[model samples]
Target chain A: EPEVTQTPSHQVTQMGQEVILRCVPISNHLYFYWYRQILGQKVEFLVSFYNNEISEKSEIFDDQFSVERPDGSNFTLKIRSTKLEDSAMYFCASTSYRAGNSPLHFGNGTRLTVT
Target chain B: LAKTTQPISMDSYEGQEVNITCSHNNIATNDYITWYQQFPSQGPRFIIQGYKTKVTNEVASLFIPADRKSSTLSLPRVSLSDTAVYYCLVGDDNTNAGKSTFGDGTTLTVKP
Candidate 1:
């Protein structure tokens, strides 16, 4: 089965530094999403992208955060100034509208560690 | 979408059936109940999804009450590898509703 692919399985960056997490969604998928989970916490929705534009976003996706689909296949989430609390496991998901119903396929995840 | 209530943790033995129930008293008409499993250091994986009645798949079965206020996830003859955090999410299946929020998941430990 085709799967979502995320680069940099693990990243350690200093606070206030800019970081960009990349994901290559399934070729035919149309929707993209980003979520994060702090240690011992529930997974939180960050943003959703469709039609090459942001369709929805949560409070966590503030001015410091941004998402872009620079290429047809590449989706990215960039944090301009990371804070210590920004440390978490970030996941990328993509979904297809084909067949009967759509199911989101998720990547292994990018573990962002801010020091 | 509606918030859900579930036990924080559960313990089961290998080869035993594991059932995790989630209560959502305020489920909306457009909402669908979905269950996901997450192992440590990995992304969550979809287990089962249902709007009503009983939906069964190779990995698990989902039972939804007629009232649609609650749902149960049943795993038949689970193994140690089934140990993971299980999340019950209430959301719309609409193509545009992609960012479904996850509640505090129930941690299941399947021991040998």
Candidate 2:
């Protein structure tokens, strides 16, 4: 079974630094999404991407956060300035179909740790 | 999107059946109930999804009542390795619908 893959399984950064998390979605999937989970907290939606553009985003996806599909297979989440609260497990997901019958497939998350 | 209410934790002995129930009092007409399992340090894995009645796969079972306001995830004869956090999410599955949010999952521990 093909699965979503994320790079830099663990990252450590200082506050105020920029961080880019990378994800390679399933080759044939069309929709992409990014979600984060603070330690001991619920997983929160960050942004959803489709057709090289952002389809939907949450309040947490503010001015400092952006997502780009730089290439056919690469979807990246960039945080302009990392805050301590930004430290969490970031997960990438993709799906061939959008909703109803098919559920999004998730990748093993990238643990982001900011000081 | 509907807010789901599931247990905070559950424990069962190896080889025992475990049922985790989730309540979504305000589930939408088009909303579906989906369950995911997450091991520590990894992302949540889709276990099963269902709309009504019962649906079963090789790993688990999902039972949704007629009202669609609640669902139950049943893990039969669980083993120690089955220990993980289980999240029940209610939403439409498409980008056109909305982004899905996972609530604080129920941590399930299967002991020997």
CAPRI-style docking class of model 2 based on DockQ: medium
Chain A in model 1: its TM-score?
Answer: 0.94
Name the 10 consecutive residues with the lowest summed lDDT in model 2 chain B.
B92-101
DockQ of each: 0.46, 0.58
Q: Chain A TM-score of each model, in the order shown?
A: 0.94, 0.97
**Fnat across every predicted model, in order:** 0.39, 0.57
Query: Considering summed lDDT, which 10 consecutive residues are worst modelled in model 1 chain B?
Result: B92-101
CAPRI-style grade of the A/B interface in model 1: acceptable
C-alpha lDDT of residue A105 in model 2: 86
- What would the TM-scores of all predictions be? 0.94, 0.95
Model 1 residue A43 CA deviation (Å) reads 0.4
Residue B10 displacement in candidate 2 (angstroms):
0.6
lDDT tens digits by residue: candidate 1, A39-75: 8888888998889788888988999999999988999
